[model samples]
Target chain A: MNGKYRFLLAALPLAVVIGLSGFFYDRLGKDPGELPSVLIGKPVPEFTLPGLEDGAPGLASADLRSGTVTIVNVFASWCAPCRIEHPMLTALAKVPKIRLVGIAYKDKIEATRAFLGELGNPYALIGADVTGRVAIDWGVYGVPETYLVSPGGEIVWKHVGPLDETVIRGELLPRAEKLLK
Target chain B: MKFLLRLSSPRRRPGPFAGRVPLSARDPGLRRDDARGWRALALATVLFLSAVPALAIGVDEPMADPAMEAKARDIARGLRCLVCQNQSIEDSNAPLAADLRHIVRERLAAGEDEAAIQKYLVDRYGEWVLMRPPFEPATYALWFGPAALLLTGVGVILWRRRHPATVPEAEALTAEERARLDRLLKDEDPA
Candidate 1:
């Protein structure tokens, strides 16, 4: 081969090697947990924890089946989104044929009660996950993740992140109404 | 003594060949060694070329516990280091990424749930810290862009590979150029 062509031929594989190196390097550092969820429409993880109110009953999976559609809200006293979603939660609680419960994730009992007091109680039954064990059991990535538990106690739908009035009227209500029947 | 003198004589050194040859001219075997030297150089270059990338990936600092490091890596994979758009906080060595990793460990150590820790980060940093942005109408493009790009790239590559270059149609040859080509071919050059 001519000198220039020989040099070019040799450099082609080097270029490909550089490209492959960059591609693999880019892929190797990828965060695997960011994998798009496969859990949509699947049954939610089960949890049973003590209810936040003193002398009140603890919450269990069976409680979600008490002949009412329930929203199991995963919230923490420190979560700002939960505060933003509070009014929507309160509104949803007032919606007939639907009930709302709060699961206090990784928060102290006193702080959770104080927060509820300051922001008007919206849950019919509140559960405390003081060590956050229950939140993990629910596969929660963050709050306020609301799960719509059917009257049969099946976790029919999950809303990850804060709730909004739009979600209430549009997505959650439409789905919960179907499950209610 | 005369025979010994003839053997040691330098009389041949004054000929026209004085400057033309060096000591290696005495050995025909060494004449072929130039080819061997070129082959050795090519071999050395090929070996050096293959060793570079293998050396680079192996040089990272070793973590104290590869298991917790793997977990930290897994958690970091889900977290976006706010300073960079393309890298996970786990893969980033940015000061903020390091601080976020430390906070994750601290939360884990405190018996806080993984969800609570992630939620705390989201609360502090806003949802932008999440590697996988939440599914909402606002993020529909992000969620769907990869598939769209894949299809677009495939279409482009396939089109480019299948299309052939068009040959130009015969042009009306310029009078002068046609005459010149005809003369050269006929070996006449009448012009």
Candidate 2:
């Protein structure tokens, strides 16, 4: 073979091997994007957070009643995926059987209020988790995490990431309905 | 697309240019000129586009969207921490790393484009901030060396398989080897 062709032949296998390794490395290193709940089947963390809506009295663990299925959503004004998932939260609010509440994780009141105002508040009671201690207790790695709390205050399921219409309709509602029954 | 591909592709030149400049008397003026030219280019690029100050402007003020904060964290996790090698900004606790994380959040809340945000960070911290170093002459080995090594290894294995080493089954034993074996066995004998 000529010099250039020989060089090309030598380079081709090297390129192929590298491309294959990179493809596998990317595939193997990728985060599965599913955050498994450490709080599953455990009691919901006890917290007293200031309410976002009426600015009324704060919400506490005692507020959760038995026999009702509630979705406690952790959100912040700074989370974009929360915005993506807001419509789903709003739709879930209209479902009478499911009580949807929002926890404003480590965010200021003004920002939280503006965010809700623009997105349309779907939460029955929005709690300000100012210090993020409550969020940490709930094992929240990031915002837009939702937990399904049984009437008995037992956290039955958690869905990490944004709650889209598909997630709410498919994963949350079906599981909640089962809990309610 | 071609620009992006170029940015992502690793380029290696194993020619004479790849070696470091030897500080010898040979072509001293020319080598000095080359080094100076590269230094000037790096400095000019750093100075012209550095938007480091823009990171601090909007953070002190309260944001209108708290949700963007979470998005910022997600983006930061994807971003490599400039000051700390091989660590994502979200996972790093260094003061500059923290500042970078806060800046990313602030910028995201202010509605910065992802590419622009990445570029802004790169301009401030240089290409080192990027976890996946852009394919360039300097980073060619980091990106493509392993594959080259693997190919070479496979080639060696194939060559070894095609040209197996010959061995003598019986005549291989030398006189000295036979004497040593006999001595070893005699020492260990029960009799």
For candidate 1, the C-alpha RMSD (Å) to the true structure equals 19.4
Worst 10 residues of 1 chain B by lDDT: B1-10
Candidate 2 lDDT over residue span A24-104, tens digit each: 988793446444565687788677888764658666787665457889999999989999888888888999888988889
Q: How do the residues B1-191 of candidate 2 rate in per-residue lDDT, one tens digit apiece?
A: 22332333334212375337442234445444555556666787887667554443333343456566556656777777644556887676554466666667666767797777888766434565566678889999998899999999999899779978657486677999999888888897745
Q: Could you give the DockQ of candidate 2?
A: 0.03
Two-chain DockQ for each candidate model? 0.02, 0.03
The global C-alpha lDDT for each of the candidates, from Candidate 1 onward, is 0.72, 0.73
lDDT of 1 by residue, B1-191 (tens): 22332334434232466447653475454435545555666887888987864543232343466665566557767988755657876666554466567667666656676678788777444577788889999998998999999999999799767875456699898999999788789986456
Candidate 2 ranges beyond 4 A from true positions: A1-31, A53-55, B1-191
